[model samples]
Target: MPDAGHPAAGAAGGSVPHRPARLPLVLLRSPWFIGLTVVTLACIVAVFTGPLGRPLDVALNLVLAALDLATAANAFSTARHFPSRPVRRLALGVGLIATIYLISDLTEAVGTATGLLASQETLANVTIVGSNLVLLGLLLRYPTGARSRSDRLTFWLDAGSVLVGAGVITWCLMLGPRREGWSLEHLATALGTAVLLAMVAFAVVRLMLSKRPPLARAPTIWAVGSTFVLYASSLVHASPELLLRIGLADDLASSFLMMVALWTHRVQLRLDPDILRRRRRKPFSALPYLAMAAMFVVVVFVVPEGLGMRSISALGGLAVISLLVVLRQLLAFAGNAQLLRRLDRTLVDLRAHQHRLRALLDHAYDITLTVDPRGRMSYLSPAVERTLGVPPAALRGSRWRTPLHPQDARNLMRAVPALLAAAGTTVTWQVRARSTDGTWRWLEVVCTNLLHEPAVCGVVCNARDVTESRDLHDRLRFQAFHDPLTGLANRMLFTERLIAALTEVPEKPVSVLLLDLDGFKEINDVWGHHAGDTVLVTVASRLTAAVRDQDTVARLGGDEFGVLLVGTDRAEAERVTERLERQLEEPMALDPGPAEATVRVVAGASIGIATRDGECFPDPSPPVDAMLKAADAQMYRRKRLRRTGGGRQTGRG
Candidate 1:
């Protein structure tokens, strides 16, 4: 939308989304228009009546003053409601100009009605000149779209040509012809009228030639029409052949046009300034050419009267006009050359930047995608195929979250609305994505909001694959708590489970069984360390098979192993011990190597059982160290009994 400070639509940050509303039709039926029309008809009737008597003339002047005063009041009141700064300033300037016109009309009326104000003609002319000067100032001070220094310079050159040519025409028409017995006052009046006409011409020309006009086309056209009428009226009033009453009628019509211009502007202010279309300007204005043609016509008419000082002056003015035109063309050519050079450099830099961006997007390990406000993928980089095993073209226009795990997709969809609500916010999240190979891969995605940016207008996502790292982390966690060789729980894991069972439910029956191979060391000495490893592997397998799936079996150290039985008492523990004993006793077949025959050997294990019982255990009732010590004592007692000829298969708890 156009900014309040600038009036030109589509200028820099001035793009609009809708067409500007037209002027209100009710203005045609407005009281100001009706009154002005009635006054115009009366002025025409009075002009055709041959003699405007003093009483009637004073009445008309007073009526015109009143009309001007009303216009000024309306302008001032409407200006207060305008939202645009430039529009408001223009409305206020119009009010001030109308107020000056009112003062001029009042001065003329007072002079006609009363003879006390002797210098009324001079005062009236001064006020009228002051008002034109104010209009000139307002036209020049109005803002235009931003332009280059060269463009502004060219505009001024063209303006200077028109102004210089108008000066020649003003001199030829108002002051060139000889006048016999002319008074100083008469000469002064003619000169003032000529200067005022030139000012009006310049104001109109400047408004038309503006690259970005402060007013819309309709209002500006009406304003230009008003000034042109004033210029024509001043010329007719200065001429000796035209009736003075006709000039007055033209003045009345010019005032009417100005009022219409103000009313149109008021209607414009009621609509959104952002939707108003500014007038487009031509590449080159023909106004200077028209001014030169007028000057030449004036010179042709004045030259045939004889070769005099005015003739020479008119020819010299034509030469100056020619020089200005040539200089303006040269400046335009130079400015074009400079613009072309700058454009070429900008194109070269843009191409180089694009090449570098393409290289980065193609080679980067991370996949980059742009998602529009509709949640569809607008762009995906070349790395998408390499990282996700999915082609970029297939995903374009599809939702980027389609391949994500169900929970992750839901979470991303929920967060997308918040991320889009604020511009430039960024979020990073990890999601599991199903690849073409039917394996779920981890992707760490960083999404940044750029919906406010005109060039981007989408959210940018950079995703990097992290599946290998995640798998390595899981393996490391498993190795921290389990034995690497036997794939069974280690001593640390067994102790942790025992402590958890004791603290979770204190009244629940829990027991630990400790076991030691009877002659495992002798087997390693006889068949090398390879045979000892084989025996340990076989014994671990049998122990795991003998217990329930919920029970935990661990390699304590060396040839010793441990088992934790939950919800079990002494009798249950003894039954498990007998099953473990039978499995270990039957596993005896072994092969030393391919070169040796198979040998049968019995690898028996001594077992001990300790149940958690507050009545049997000493001071530290259910502590982990106290329970482990009780089981160790029972295992040693059983080993001693077997060695001293007391045959015992299981130890008492």
Candidate 2:
């Protein structure tokens, strides 16, 4: 549904505007057109100055009144065609006044034609006075776009202040002057005229003081001009000579102004429906000051001529004006002080909020960073010093990748574009970064893209030092796959590596060696299990040192040990077996106590070797269990030969 108060909305709701001819609107707006119209009206008024009889004069007056009525009716009818309720109501008031004027003019014209001028003149005067009062009431009640109580109050205050100053001047110039031997009728006429003048003053003030007037500025200006001309015409009627010469001329000029106002109103309405709804508030008005200055001028001019009752009265009014000015200034000062106080409170609240936010960011365990789209750090939180061992200022405006390890930096570069592509998303990654001490530390970083947010127009990164946790995890994993006593690969990891070397690349040569410690039970009985453990530890170290770095060395339970050598053929396996024998031949030291001397013992082992090459497994890879069984059988066979004195003797097996 369209808004009923706005003409544009009504037009959208299917109301067709009555478009008037543009010729009249153009002519009315032109200065030359107005001057020509005034000249024509003056000529018409000059016709009344001729020695024309009463009937012809009455006929001319009737024609002029009819013309005025037609223009007023045209304006009212056009306003009715529009949807604006305010314009229609305003037009109704103008139409009522125009109708009363036409009726007053008709009464005098008809009475003159019928030779009943005395009674009709009184009726006309009464009607004019009533119309003036009605006009003043309308000026007070009519809406002038003041929508709030404060706005309306301010409008009236400014208007009242200006009116007071103008009233003082009007009294001094016109009303204060006393004429000799005035009759009762003359006195009554003077009082009525004074009242009418005050009414005109108020209308002019209201028109000028309203910041957002109900009508368009140009139309309202034309309307105010018409009011001034009508008021002047009413005053001229007091002089018989002026009345005979230019009385009708005043009416014609006023009608011209009214006609222009109506035409301008129509033109504006056709152009834009809500053109009159201009809202602007000025903080200051010079009207009161201007009024005060005028009052001072009046006092200066009036006091120089001698202090009479009028002078005394003017002085009193001046004092009242000065007090009003002071009171208004005080109110303005109070408003300004209240505004300043409110601004200070708002600023304090903002500062407190900022303080709390900074405190949280500083105390957090995470090192938060604000990074721009170009990957430069805009802000690094104070927590960075505690976590990264570097102050925040050292990293700000630098690239986020600056502290990252080269390999991690490359990985992060690959991931960052994908992260930024999904704007406003959060992603977590663990990367290595170099701390201030030049050691790489693991960091768990969470990044969120917030470039679209006004307050945080960047990517937010929350990085935590996770190096301790990472080290603990690595230790746990190592314990799971390694021997706790010797820090060597356990049976599980040895089997896994052997299987991988055989199955992953079946064509590669691989070798496995199994050795059982000789006379290990005798040593445990002679030196106790403590010395036995030391012997096992020394043997494990020697075996690991003898094998290639890539070979797997593991304790295969009890006093047995195993080695896995990848990419080794039978010849290389035999040479590695010889090296292991030589390493075991080196003595193992067993210290009993501080009180006892250190004893030397030799730890020897019966060794077995199994090799897999293209010749051993021509097509399919050898099974892991098969390789272990082969190595074990060979080791047992060598032990039996050593016991039977059939194997080569290096040391006691």
Candidate 3:
């Protein structure tokens, strides 16, 4: 299933999945489209309307300002979507240029409407010129993906050329309205036109070789085209063919197209869900462009023109516009500074989050680690060094498997890829891992699928030491089935073996011998229980030694023992019983306890035997419990004979 929050489904449904689409095709029909339609209709109506009077001027300027502001909003919205810093810088730069255009247009309109300007080309025209140059400089760095130090160089060089060219042209072609004579105007125009022509040749050559094509070239090209349109609008009074109203309207249309085109990469670089609420920050360098425009205003209207005293009462209005531009620049800088401070706080909070993550890893069982797709360790907790006696740094990278026990490596390696692809599950297995001290340590390892998480885009593993517990469990198992004193199979173990033997085919004859020690209790009565314990231990040792290695010897109970003889006939069973009687007839020496004297007490064996030879019993053998009971009865009968000093004999099958 796809995550509902995602704009498009991913093959993995993870954070930071591939971009939603190559372009937001739906945007063409969205609310922005409708807004663009209304603005276009308004721009066409304003352009085609009647006269060049104050009311038409105010209405046209208001509509142009709205279009410029809408363009800024569009660029800013695109900036908000891009995660790249360079992309945001370029986007917001275009937006700032549009906003300055809005202010400059509104100022000129107001100055014209109030009859305050002697010429339409005032310091407000200077603002338009400077802002257009700024836009051209920023456009040189468009798309921001392919970059070099030369980008900054190209930006400054082209901007300087455009600014100088515009200033000279402004002074030469448009200064006839001012008191400055034709002498200044003719020289400035000729020199500036010649300089611009030379720079154009150089710019064409440079742009040819230095160009890095953008992924979305149309937007930036339109953006550069829009800057040229604004520049052409400023040259409106200088050129007789292009009218002011028509030039400004065309500039607004270009601006709108440029703004729409800026969203080209928005569909390539999708929004980060985590930063949805974060404000897109502007670059510090953006403030200076506005400052330079404000200074342009001050120079054209304040100092150079004697505070506009001769110019249609323009001093007060130009001062207010200049002040407003300066204030807007200052406020933008202040807001950007505040956003930088908030970013610093976010960095501090991120550090605190990392501290908490480390603490959790430290306290959890075992050492934690993350491994990349190639099975190389990417991250290892401090506990890794503490537990494995190897530095975490040493185990990182391609050396991740350096400490794996060779015997377990093949299986673990084979399972790793499948484990990582398991999505949201865990796999567990035990392996013998090599430690720094040259010993193999058993580890219980658990690996979880965390490949979907960007921070942990790999498998997370936790390995804990279980060597001590494993050893204790083995020892407990041994003690449960073996006799403590003799270290031989006890009654329970012997019974299980007997039952297993009965289940097998009776082709091979078998015999069970039940033996009671003759006069064994008398040794305890004379010497003490300590001496008797020593006697029983010695008898068990002799019993084990007397039989073939494959035969079973068990301590059934106090002073009684049982033996299983495989592949034995009636005659062979009798011979084995006689040999067991002779082996126990010898005397055994015992050390009773500390400081107690030695007592050499003698003991003999009374043995009973049961055989399954198919002659005495039916086709099938008797059950293990019934066979053992019959053997015990025969052993008591032998005990009577031993007490009466009768001859040694074995029971027939």
Name the top lDDT candidate: 1
lDDT of each: 0.76, 0.73, 0.64
Q: Identify the runs in model 3 with alpha carbons over 4 angstroms from their true place.
A: 1-342, 359-365, 370-390, 393-421, 427-444, 451-454, 466-475, 496-513, 545-552, 563-586, 592-602, 607-624, 644-648
Candidate 2 wrongly placed segments (more than 4 Å): 1-88, 102-124, 143-156, 176-188, 203-212, 233-239, 243-247, 354-653
lDDT of 3 by residue, 18-133 (tens): 65433446565467656765776776566657555678666666766776777777778777866667557767886898789788778867887888866766655576557756
Positional deviation of residue 587's Cα in model 1 after best superposition, in angstroms: 15
Candidate 1 residue spans exceeding 4 A from truth = 1-22, 25-51, 74-100, 114-123, 133-152, 169-195, 203-219, 237-242, 262-267, 270-322, 372-378, 389-415, 422-425, 434-438, 472-653
What C-alpha lDDT, on a 0 to 100 scale, does residue 496 get in candidate 3?
83
- CA error at residue 409 for candidate 1, angstroms: 4.5
TM-score of each: 0.61, 0.49, 0.43
- lDDT of model 1, residue 610: 85
For model 2, residues 304-394, the per-residue Cα lDDT tens digits are: 7577644665687677667777767776787679889999999999999999989999899988988775668889999888876889999
Q: List the residue pairs that clash in candidate 1.
A: none
Better of 2 and 3 by lDDT: 2
| Tens digits of lDDT, candidate 1, 48-129 | 5757567766777777787687669768977797666875787788899898888878877888888566765587668767
